[model samples]
Target: MTERPEPTFDPRALVRSLPQSPGVYRMIDASGTVIYVGKARNLRRRVGSYFTRQAHNAKTQAMLAQVADVQVALTHTEAEALILENNLIKELRPRFNVLLRDDKSYPYIYLSSHQRFPRLAFHRGSRKGPGRYFGPFPSASAVRETLNHLQKVFPVRQCRDSFFENRSRPCLQYQIERCTAPCVGYISEADYARDVRHVEMFLDGDSNRVIDELVERMEAAAAALKFEEAAGLRDRIAALRRIQERQYVAGARGDVDVIACVVRESMACVQVFVIRNGTNLGNRTYFPKAPPETNSDEILYAFIAGHYLGGNAPPELIVSDDMTDREVLEEALGGDAGHRVRIRSRVRGERRRWLELAMSNAEHALSARMSTQASMDRRFEDLQERLELEAMPERMECFDISHTQGEATVASCVVFNREGPLKSDYRRFNIEGIEAGDDYAAMRQALERRYLRVKKGEAPVPDLLLIDGGRGQLAQAEAVLGELQLTDELTIAAISKGPRRRPGEEVLHIAGREDEYRLPPDAPGLHLLQQIRDEAHRFAITGHRGRRGRRRQRSSLEEIPGLGPKRRQALLKQFGGLQGVQRAGVEDLARVHGINRALAERIYETLNG
Candidate 1:
């Protein structure tokens, strides 16, 4: 088959032939990668201005320098172009675009409708389940707090369906009065349905309606001389009223989101305060990735498009900065939400107060982040000086081994960059086929596994590698790197405790050096190493403990002949725990579901031994 030829892209010729319509444009580099994406009302004027304008910002100039071709897609209106631009940016993640990094789905409170006794629980991800979802809550904690409050006022179940189905009697929730024990027939289906309705009304922001109905029920029960029933109803009404008072924003109603963006020292922070039906749900913060030249207005514009276009936009957005494309964004968001969405910068009353608060929070968060980044930079600079390196390292990795006696060994690799710990790049390895307590073998195995990926270009090679032990562990790392032909690609060092394994008294052993170096107790470079080393140790120990716990949790019954997973679960659930199962007689174990007498005898024998 013949290979397809590259398309001829002449910028001047393309600009002349472009129509004067609203559209989105993409800038491509020589490698055929999209470097930037943007939208404009007039395609010709926008595309022409790039080449005609003499005064461009540093970021735009840098982008222009790499542009080998320009591509445009026409639209009927600027709003359409705005939407298309957002989609392309999300899909392509062009290098120059202001991208929102936290795109995880927001949490919600789900009320199942498909079950006979509907369940209330915290939920995230796809809404395809047959349920009534009552939020796009700012965070999981917010959803959990709401669910907790609802459980206190309503006797609805929050347990998983499997647990709910297998119940032989009331669980802790029922004993604590948080659940009506529908699983054990303590409450009739009709009564449970009524409670579920009250929950739905409360979540829908009709707290006053729910309170009114509860008051009516309380009076009726009082008149009938049912003191206990009346008291419960009265308590629920009072609790709901208290909740409304706490959640209601003074002089605020309807659905609105308060958004504030602050840009400083080449970083940006966006604070979002979500309000639904006059109730303050909570606030969330985001740090979008952008260049230094991008302003708050541009960041706000990109954030609005990237965030709300997912069909979770509130009816009105109160913003801290005035966006140039507010009208276009409003149109796009409104179309997605099926309502008239407004993006407002100028506001008054409680909205002004909320906007101010959001702006203050954004400023505080950005300041704190920048302060930490500055500290990290200082530590990195000091480390470079101490190590006598040609330049400051961009990334560093530290390795540590953790185990108890000779069981469940684990090696942890923690990564750090100039901004501090890069947790996403941290890794843990289960050291297998080696002596249980062999630190050298564990280090060698982990380094080989990690650097093999680096050698194959699957993972980035760090500028420096640190070992948690002294000379022996360092030798393992050096040998591994030498085998992988990466010895010259990075520096290696080992940190050994000076005495009593105390902090601030550690000796550093650099590979290829004859003498060991110890930094002053207060040295910033030493502190940075300590931080990375401590993190690696913490990660390794955590992994080792988890592995050990899982291993111990596995019952000896698992090894018994003809004992399957179902029978094991049945025995554990019936007996409460492994010790309980172990103490049971063979005849008692035989009574568990799916366990025949022969299998039960085998289980009893194996567990006893």
Candidate 2:
């Protein structure tokens, strides 16, 4: 088979070429970047529907206006298309897609079964080694609490392999009865192996079975005239029972994830309860990013696809509402779990009680989220009144430049909207190709690089562009925006510090208006502008300081006569951290790919000094 050619620039030409089979399609903008990704059973029909979508929302219209090309990858089945679509969305992070903001892997309690004396460790990321994993736990603190309890109950090793191998005697853990002390041969391998088995069983949602085993052991130890060992076993069993009692929530019948979403004024908060073996481990909340006019069904569906399609799929999903593509989701999740994963909106008995609780949590969470959002909306309203804007500005971006003695200069742009800070859109630019002290040149470079994309439809233009300086900075930004021909009716304003440089006494210089504006010391609108301008200042300083620090912190590697940038970078990468480099012996330094004995000795001495 031959490789498929890249699609043409014309959207219609690309859409006409799509096969009728199921696949994933990526919408590319004029700048050759994916702006949206989607799955469809019939590629031709789905790709064609976008062009024919009547009464499209503002977001959809903006997306379609920039469409320069289309790309398709065929899959054998709709389920396959769904999987591919999810993978692409996570990898590419298209703008128009419903983005899962917090995608960090959940923590787990892990047992290393392959070692001679296996260690009980807390882990996250891929669950792929020869071991048993006990959780997709809600938080690291929860995992830590469980780990601490297990350490007391099972007495497995928790130290790293390096420290374990180098032990000269039993450590504090062994003294406190939280470890078996296999590091110094204080516990026989056979005895430690037995304890490890009990730990594994306890983590595998069979604490009752482990408790029974402990009871049997305690009785046997008592019968054998071993009072202390029997007492130890008794304590372990008690700890297990206490943990189980504390965690047990009776409403959930089996291992399931209860997902409930509450929507208010086009905003959604999805609260998830992680239930395992009829026990409620804990819960989490998420706010997926999507368009305002989008339906809750679509939001929930997209969230499910992004959150669980190919990751951790619980045996049962008790969802709050029925989705339009419910069957497709169930089929996809079922395939992912290698079982029939049920998605239920309606429940009875204990499951119903759990669902109701989850619904309450979702509503409460949404109310709190909306309350914070409403205050931000009021700030925007106040800003509209103060600036005399033609309409309420939905997106505002502010710029500030920072440097110390005109060195390591940097510029930052921070964005805000009705919901508050859009931190994902914040950007920092390193000032270059100009005099270090020239604020005008730095601002001009930042504005050109940022808005040239918007001019080419690579980015969305904010309703207002704020400059954190006097008229000179504003003039520089205005020159760039004018050069780019941004005819989208954007407002430009510059804020200068007061003559005495006081916060509330600052002046606002709006482009095309002769007079400057100010407000009372306690005005909410003035405070809002100060808040944004201060954020831009803080962001710029952080970037500038980071850059300057790296330069100042450059180690003795640069001082050595033979060590160049390449060799220094290699050494840093090999050791990974400053402390690691400092402690690395000559032998360890010599083992790196590039360094010989002479250079290694020099590096070791230099870092040690």
Candidate 3:
């Protein structure tokens, strides 16, 4: 079959033919790249307005300059249009769209009583469907710290249900009095339920009431001559007080998310402080990528829409920059959170204080970003001058080989530019079909695989390439690039470890240069090389370790019937490790969650066999 010629994009014609309904429009540039993505209540009017006599901002005008084609996908409603718009913006990451780039889910303290003895666990990702989620904590470490305090005060079982089920004796958590030993039936359901209630009250931000209740219990235990129990309660009371003291600042007595964005030149940072039930939980800063001169409210709207619609459970009050499109954003977000949402930029007293705090955080983050960028710019300039290149490399890639005495041999490529390490573009190649300990062969293989794609126009060609080795590795790299016909145009250099493995004294080897030269230890050009080379080394080592760990962990457990990822985690947590599971008796194995009698016997026989 003959391929048809590609269709030409006529923006005016496309807009002229567009249906005036709720929809999303994607503007494709001449290169067929989606340069801009947007949603509209009326597609025809919206797309037509771009070409009309309206004053388009510089950013909008720039986006339109390259737009050769317009594609519209109609939606049933404006809310659906908003949803499609968000999905497309995230999926395509168009150059002209404000992309929300949060790679981590908010942490929540999950508790469910249906497991007999509720387990207090720090959770992130999808809910368990029935359990109560106590947070959307700013960081995982915050959740971990809070969990530690809860384990001390509540003494509720914090182990996995499988681990809890398999326990024939109290674990270290119990030995340290951090758990009530309910796994071994040391605590009754009624008493454990009472402790669970205390946890609920504390998490619900009723620390004062919870502490008061604990005081009454401590006195009662003292009157009953149970000093050990009374002492435990006293410690719990102290822990509660400590938490209360740390969270003494009380303002808004409702669910509120204070959001503020600070834009510097071309960078913007959005700071979010989550205030729940009158207590300040914590704050997180998000740097949303947008044109530097982008309107604050436009950035805020995109940030909020991307976040709240992208799985965050929205709060009652969203305090941010004064968004003119507040109703559209709220309607879209409210549909997801199942609540009426309100946006406020102007507030009085405590709310204003919180908003100001958010703004300060945003400003601080943006300022730091500017400083780092300035420093990096200077360093890149220094590197450009030292390298004597045709032009300053827009993107630099450093390669390194890592392994432990030839085992798990791997090579890594790390990319960077003026902005710093482009982690998303980093690549790792697992060396194959090569003799162990042959660094030259390993490097050759990695280079061939990487540049072969560049030769085929399947990947971007970096302006500069740095390999982590002396003359021999540099020659190998040149040979690979020469085969791909890339050496003549591409700048390649090599760095070798100093004698005695000293860092600053390392040598730089280039193709035409005879004598290897060394840069002053503090030179910014050398500093840049050191950073890129170190990053490549680190990436290779980390990948090698992960490969080794995964290979080691895929043990005899994989042979067992019905033992999957979750069950394996449970067994490991219960028995401590693979070796622990191997040593466990069939009875002990049977006690693991979801591990019944027959399956336990099979696991034991399979491992022991």
Candidate 4:
């Protein structure tokens, strides 16, 4: 067989043959990797400029030297070319492109449409489900905050479909007046439907209409001699008025997004504030990965194209910086949204104020991010010097165990790296088949499970392993590593509280050393150790509490004699939950439909005991 001849590239020859049409271009190096992606209205002129231009930046000059092949995909229009460029950039992630690291979808407030009493909830993924979505809110917490406020004012049901279907009585939400207990027929269908309509109107930015209708209902109830009903309606109206006052922008209506970008020392921060129906739905900060020396306008342009093209672009965008491609972006975004979109840079009054606020936030966020990075670098250096390691530890894992009286024990492992806490690598193990209150056994089991995976090459092995107890816990970790034949690969240390059990008075015990090492109260290395150990403790306690709560919520009621699922559910519904049941006397328990005096007494005794 004969080998093919090596292919050679000539930029001038390629540019000569290129057509003068709108298209996307990819510059590939000799190794067959795309190093840059771009779009142009006149492909021939744009491609020729790279070879003809005399004044090029260092980055561009370097890119030009390595460009062995240039490819182009023709499009019908500049807008089409812009979209194709974004798609290709996201798919290929060329080294020279301004990449947007936004992988998570925005959150929305979903209102179910099929149910008789529709439910409101937080949604974050695909919108193919049968519901009316009210937002592409910046974050899940913002969606939840809006939902909570809506419930307080509208008394609409927000429970899951399963919970609503099985309800036999009013739940705690109804008692707290946040819901009307539509599941149990506490509110008539007509009245519930009215409330749902009001919720819809409020979310649609028609709060004035909702308040007006509510005032009419209040007057009607008063005229009908229903004083209690009138009072409730009056209170709902007041809450709605208060919320409207707080949320509505002074001179803004409809949907708009305020976007600001700040670039300093090759780092950039972008802040986006969402406004729907004139209400501020909160803001989120994004730090997109871009090549060095990229300006704010370029980053803002890339962000708008990559972000809004996914289909949730508002009608108007108030940007902090002016971009040369503003018209092209507006056209592309408008096409995606099926409406006209506008990008405004020079504004006055309220919109200008919003832009300034977004700019300020971006500056602050970038400063904090840079500070955190500098601090992390300093601490990592100090830790390396203190531990006498051969090099800086790139990854460290800390293990801590938590339990209450040996029940529902949980072992948590928190990982940290040079950048900071690596939350994605954090793990929690539910320890089993161990003697109660045996921290050593719990630690041993957790390490065995975790390292078994590391041995199989399933996870990265950390350079350091920090245990959260004294010599005993450290011994368990050492034994486990020895069994796995990984003792020589990583360092081991344990942190234990000093004699007085205080923050700055902790002793660190290294595996191969006889005497414990103690650092000064203000040592950076000690501060780093304390941060990781405290995080492990927090994670462990959180897991332990959740496991304990779920176990008790189900087991405590099931253990009682003559208390089947029906009786237990009935008691829970009447009293609201397990804590309410625990607080109720035997007489109060017997008042439930299925519980008799004898069974009630038995339940009280079992729960109280």
Candidate 5:
């Protein structure tokens, strides 16, 4: 193998400039655009690793060759570097990085402690101000479920602290038996405080004690002949039982948090089950990205460190695989949670059983995901063969144009990388230099503009270009690309509306073929194309409808004959729209503030007599 000459730019100079401390590092291009972001324990040595000839892969080599400048932010510790890395990646969103881009903020159940009488509420984000925040729950419905259970079992008031303090009488919550109405002094302050304590206990996993108290209350109410009150207590007890019923996977013993991970190539799945007081709160699965060469321990170590860095850390974590630095992880999480934490591999007894179950789930989930991806790959290959392309189109770009009766002309390009739709790569264009309602012209403009960047090496060149149309539209796109001298570099195809828009009967337009090919209604390859085409149509239509809506907002019926501004406004205000007026009777249109009977009758007849 021939050795490539190194750049004269001194990495030692860069390393010497960096402080020998924990920090986050950035590799930037000549334009100062960051190509990759990394965290380092020792900034100099860590950044120096990229310059080493033996330590580089094709991806990292490509990243390094593009680097023109290095940026570093010194942190207090390696842990701080990790946190800063996640934050920066989330913000900058550099290429060659995997991220949790779901945009969903974890939910929490907060019990307000600021007022004389506390109240429970569902919340997301921080624990700022005064409140007892209980989750970072997986979903809103999960928080609601726990809230329902807490309200029934603990008698906690679900209201704002301000509302609780201002109440002069029992509210509807009291009538509905959802609350004890401590806001109106229906329950004594001490008793309410006791109820809050019980809630805290329940959340803290003292389920047995909480149940004992509820049972005692029920017995006391029954002995006093307050059977109605006793019945309410019975319901509370049943609710607790119901909660237990929902948690069917509860372990026999141990407060063990079982962690399992599955890895296939660069993709990884981490499953964590939190068992507190022998009840499984729940199990959550995380798909973390790791280097292919890295073993399970390193991945698991990094995963645990990153996972518990911002969330609640369990006391005892049992993993399916061993971690490189289990003690360091335990110490780090222990400091965060203000408790002694243990991270260990599977042990004997029920803890091991939980670990096995979690591992099983991880394996199944990973297998299913990989299977789905493989099927998509097979379909993509089949699509390429059917289209008779030189190579498979792993990166397909589909173009669609949407308009409403020659108004709000817009075009959209949806890019599908090897995975399903890369929504981030989707682009929308406003058509110009073309008549409105001219979909072929609009598509030509979009493709020309899109490929102009591809020629300049500013945008990725897709393996295949897909236009939503028949031969006429495809020819328009072909001519545009041909004029730009880009037709040979790319394969273009067109998808027209299937028979009666029946998905599978789609017509595929190829460049040289006189007649378009039709895929059978039942072919898997055809179904795949239909899905992609439908998604593109849906995306374009949505974009066009949004533009149309804005245009409509700026339009008025006064533009038509016999409709003055005032009368049009009156009609719109009364009937909402032409459709509404069409559905309305003459009497209904006449009921408008400014509409007379004759004009209203005329309007109704004009719409739909």
Candidate 6:
């Protein structure tokens, strides 16, 4: 291969400007959009490597050739550089980098500590407040399912302290035996405190002990002729047993974290399984980036030091391998956690079994990623052959519109580069100018908004653009691109449903082509188009539904004057919906918190008068 030219920018000038320290560097276009991001030990040599002829791969050559500017942020050390790189790539989203697009925050189960009667809740995003958060669980439903099981196993309150205190009678949590209802005197403060202690024990990994105590209480209650309470306790105990059975039992290891690392083609994926008292609570995966030449030991060392720089800590961490400065790392982690951190290698026994489980998960994850990549490459090749393009449409973008009788119209733009779905690049638009039910106008609006960004150099102009419609939709999109003088800058096509809304039969339109083309029902190229079109449609529909849901939330009197969060919550507690609030009397309104006499009268007059 011919050597690519060095970037026209001054190398010495760049190095002189950069600190002889650790940090992340970005190669940017004249417009200041980051094309690639990297971390460096010797800021001079690492960056100089990019400008050298022999150092450039076809990909890096293309990336560097476009570099008109360089941006750098100095860090304290190489480990900090690694972390700063990951965070910047996540935020700036450079083009010529292998990115992890599904950056959605994981769900967690939180037992609120701020309230007198703390509730077990499903939470996501920041854990910036007072709570005992027990997970970075895989999904919201996963946390909810665990919360449901926890409620059954432990008779602790799941209502706010205010709601708990104001209750004249036991609520459904008490009726369902999930709560002791201390607010209504059904359970005493001391007894509720004991229940809270048991809950803490359960969360701390002493599930059997918690259940044993509950079982004993139930037996005693039955012996005292409290049959109803005893039966409820029996159900709870049974549920706890069921939950315990579901957990994977590892012999005699208490509250340990098993971590395994898998590195492939310079990308490292770390798998973590949280085990509490020998039972596997849950597992999560982290794909951390580092220097291309870095080894597993070096990567893990950085991962531990940088990952937990501000993150939560587990007392015992079981790893597949040991670190060089295990003592220093443990101490650093301990300082952050305010508890001694134990770092152990996977040895033969229960610890080894836990490590094996984590490795197995890492293997499965890598296998899935490889499969997705292979499928994507194959689909791209097939598209290239069909479209007769200069190259494979390595970066394909699909557009679709969604509406509910035109009431809540929305459009979605989804990107799939060489790897697979670039989820982070996926965007949603609220269709502003189109009339309800006008799909063509909606398509036009979406394309204009998308291409205008391209025109302004705000987004990468995709190699191909797939529209989810027929010739008419294709015409509107074509017109927009023409007006923007980018008609040939992007390859455009449309996929439309066939006669009678059939599954396989479909019509396709290409720019400047008068006749619609038909492909074999199972043609690979056609199937690829269908897949892209379907994904765009799914994305659009999901966005539309979310917007409609939020709109429904806003239209209620909950948004009316003087109805704050506390009062709105109280109204929801009494009345299920807006109609219920409307029908509620002045006295009922006054019963809600923060409503008071005047506010209640204002609400009553607004509704009834």
**Tens digit per residue, CA lDDT, model 3, 1-609:** 999998776667787798989999999988889988999999999889999756988998888889888888999988888988988898899988888764546778999866678888767678867879988887554665677677768888766666678879886556556678888889899999999999999899888899889899899999999999899889889878887777655667777888898887888889988777777777776778897469888998888888888556445655667876677777888888888777888798977887888888888878876888767866876777776654456689999999888878889999997679999999999998999899999999999989875544346678789999999999999888864445644578999989988878989988877877788888888899999999999999999998777556566788677899899899999988787988899999999889999999999888788
Score candidate 1 by TM-score against the native.
Answer: 0.62
- Kindly indicate the candidate among 1 and 4 with the higher TM-score: 4
Residue-level lDDT for 172 in candidate 1: 58
The global C-alpha lDDT for each of the candidates, from Candidate 1 onward, is 0.87, 0.81, 0.82, 0.87, 0.73, 0.73
- Candidate 6, residue 69: how far the Cα is off, in Å: 4.1
Q: What is the lDDT, from 0 to 100, of the residue 320 in candidate 3?
A: 65
Work out how many backbone clashes candidate 6 has: 1
Residue-pair clashes per candidate, as listed? 0, 0, 1, 0, 0, 1
Residue-wise C-alpha lDDT for candidate 2, range 173-274, written one tens digit per residue: 676677778988988999998888887777667788888988999999999999999998898888888888988877656689888887778787788888
Say which prediction, candidate 3 or candidate 5, comes out ahead on TM-score. 3
Candidate 5 per-residue C-alpha lDDT over 77-97 given as tens digits, one digit per residue, 9 for 90 to 100: 876777687668767866755
RMSD of 2: 23.0
TM-score: model 5 vs. ground truth: 0.53
Write candidate 1's Cα lDDT for 271-333 as tens digits.
999999889998987788897699999999999999988799988999998988788899989
Candidate with the larger lDDT of 3 and 6: 3
Superposition error at 223 for model 5 (Å):
3.4
Find the 10 residues in a row with the least total lDDT in model 5: 96-105
Q: Which predicted model would earn the best lDDT?
A: 4
The model with the greatest TM-score is 4
Q: Report how far off residue 346 is in candidate 1 (Å).
A: 1.0
The list of candidate 3 runs beyond 4 A from truth reads 1-10, 102-104, 373-609
Q: Where is model 1 more than 4 Å wrong at Cα?
A: 1-10, 220-225, 373-609
Screening candidate 1 with a backbone cut-off below 3 angstroms (N, C-alpha, C), the clashing residue pairs are none
Q: How accurate is candidate 6 locally (lDDT)?
A: 0.73
